[model samples]
Structures are given as C-alpha cells and as structure tokens.
Target: MSISFLAKHPVPCSLFLLGILVLGHGAYIQAKAYLAQFLIAQAWQQTLDDQQVHKPWQWADTYPVAKLSFVTKQESIGFKHQVESVYVLAGASGRTLAFGPGLVLSGAKIGEVGNTVIAGHRDTHFANLAAVNKGDLLQVEASNGEILLYQVVNTQIAHQSDTQFMAPSDDNRLTLITCYPFNQLSGGAEQRYIVEALYVNKPSAI
Candidate 1:
C-alpha cells in the first residue's frame, strides 16, 4: 500500500524520504563513526602485528597510529560492548577526523620528547573530554607496543587561532584538542577546548 501510494504521489513521497534522511543524518554520522572505529581497531591490531601502518579501509587516507585510553581500566581490545578508549589516526584533516581523533602532523612524534597534539570532533569522540579533569591519567599506546603515560596538567578554553596551545614543547607533553562549548549544536566554533598533559616518566597500572 505504501509503495502504491508512493507511485501515485511520487513528488510527495520523494520529499518525505528526503526529510527522513535529513532528520536521521546525525544518527547516521554517529553510527558511521563507531563502525569506522571498529574497522580502525582491526587495522591497528594488524599494524602492531606486522609493524607497519594499515588503513582501516581500502580508500582511507589515514591509518591508526596509537590507541588512546581515557579511563584507566583493564579493557580488552576487540571492540568491547563498552569501550572507553579510541584509536588515534594519523593526520588531523577533516576526512580523517570524521572516523576518529587525529594526530596533528605538525606536533612531535608519538612517545617522543615533545608535545603531541590530537584533535577530535566535540559531538562525537571528544565529548567525554569535557569530563576529563586535571590530574587524570591518560594512556597512549604507540604502534610499537610501548605505552606512554601522561598526567593531565591543565584544561583551558582558548580561541581557535591560539596556536600556542598546539606549539611544540621541549618537555614531553600530550595535548588533546576539541571544539569549545561542547554543548553547541552548530559547527564553525571560534573557540577550542584544550587538555594538556605532561608525560609521566613512570607507567601506572593503566
């Protein structure tokens, strides 16, 4: 009956279909984000197994470089039912960031003696970052099976043009960046939420 009605009212049916797609766009993007991470984790595991970079998909321009563990806990890999961690992909470009947080190429290399910057979408992966407070421990697992630990030192809100927050540092540090005002529903935010953590010399139970 619905198909017959659509056949008789093609224009109206088309409009209704488009409206449904428009309304579901947000959910589609979110579902894609999580699904992409599952594929990305597979690639990351392969990267670690083979000691080489692997793209999550054949057309993906970026590859996962490190696994970021936000909440300190014993979480097994393999995309668990409740995952608190994310795989950080290479390059902070829009296309790369859509799937997961991206590592800024201008920043220092991972696990190096300099600042490493990572950025993500506020509505998705980085939303939980707002809950991250100073003194919280974050763990980054590099592709080489080395775990780099960091202790959050500061959390600040800054204008988007403030490049100083992502600037290279002599001291080993990790900078997590996302659009400011996490509650904002629109895009083109002029501010950024910054989370800076200093690399811990010793590793914790994370």
Candidate 2:
C-alpha cells in the first residue's frame, strides 16, 4: 500500500488491529459502549422532538423526554413517564443506527396516572449517571418542542429482583434505573442504581 493510502486508512487499520487484540476481552462490550453513546445521543434528540410534537398526551399518550446530568455521582440517567412497566432490559430491537444497535429504553410509555419507569445499562451506557444527584436540573425536550424540567430528589440501589423501582406513584415522577456498582465487569450485577426525579415544571415551548 502507498504511504499516503496507509496514512489515510490509519484509524480504520488501527481499529481493525485493536479489534483483533481485544476480540475476546469484552470486545463486544467495548464496541457496544461506543455504539450506545451514539445511539443514546440520537435517541435522546429524537425522543425529545417527538414528545414535544405529539405530546403523546394529545393522542395515544406518552412520557416526557429523558436527559443526562452529572449532579450526583450516584444517580442514573433520567427519563419521565406516567406509569411503570415490569422491568426494562437492554437488547437489539428498538431503533437501528450502525450495524443494528438495539432496543434500549425509548423513554417510558406514559401510563394512566403514576410514575413512569425507564431503564438502561450502567457501566457503559449510563456511566455518566454516577454524577447525578438531588436537585440537579433535568431538561426533557418533547417532540413538539416542549421542554419538561425535573429535579432529582433521591438515589438508591435496589436489588436485582426488586420491582419496587418500577412502582406507581401519586405524583408525576421519573425514575432511571441501571446496573449497580457503576462499573460491573461480570455482565450482571446484584443490584441496580436508581435515580428518583420529581416533576419540577415544564419550560416554555421550544
């Protein structure tokens, strides 16, 4: 190969070389981490747009957008909703970006009248969540350009089998759940990091 060609393809060649080296040592995990960052970034924007546009409350009903914060080093990534599901897991089924990402939680579907629960992976995807804390500002932008702000109220670590994290509530609340320990390497963990957000108020239509 020409020197110029080698120079131009350095990154791709280095990535290929690195891939071969780390193929067995959490290669998929590392790759997924990089992909998850991009995927979540895009999903965040789209979800916010759609939420503001349709305002799910107008037609079928949906939850507000989710936002990332570093207010607490123990909180998880945040999102909003009206109700909770059973348990959320990460997989390959939602929107596809590069090489088919997967169905990561697309914000909690607005429930009738309760807290909306959303979940994701902690170590890779929600690593930044560890900095989220009470009183931290969360700005969820809807599809229709509406901005929903939330305030972090609490943080906790629930058991792996704990379903109370997804429980219903009397107030318009938001819950973010992820694997506990922040940086688990054995895949599954014994606990989950939960961030509780209280609805502060909606910002002006954006």
Across 90-186, the per-residue lDDT of candidate 1 in tens digits comes to 9999998888899999999889888899999998888889888776778889999997778778899999988998888899999999998999998
Off by over 4 Å in 2: 1-113, 202-206
> Candidate 2, residues 59-109: lDDT per residue as tens digits?
312222334333322234444332211111223232221222122343343
On the 0 to 100 scale, the lDDT of residue 54 in model 1 is 94
For residue 25, give model 1's deviation from the true position in Å.
6.3
Residue 87 alpha-carbon offset, candidate 2, angstroms: 19
Best candidate according to lDDT: 1
lDDT of each: 0.86, 0.53
The all-Cα superposition gives candidate 1 an RMSD in Å to the true structure of 5.1
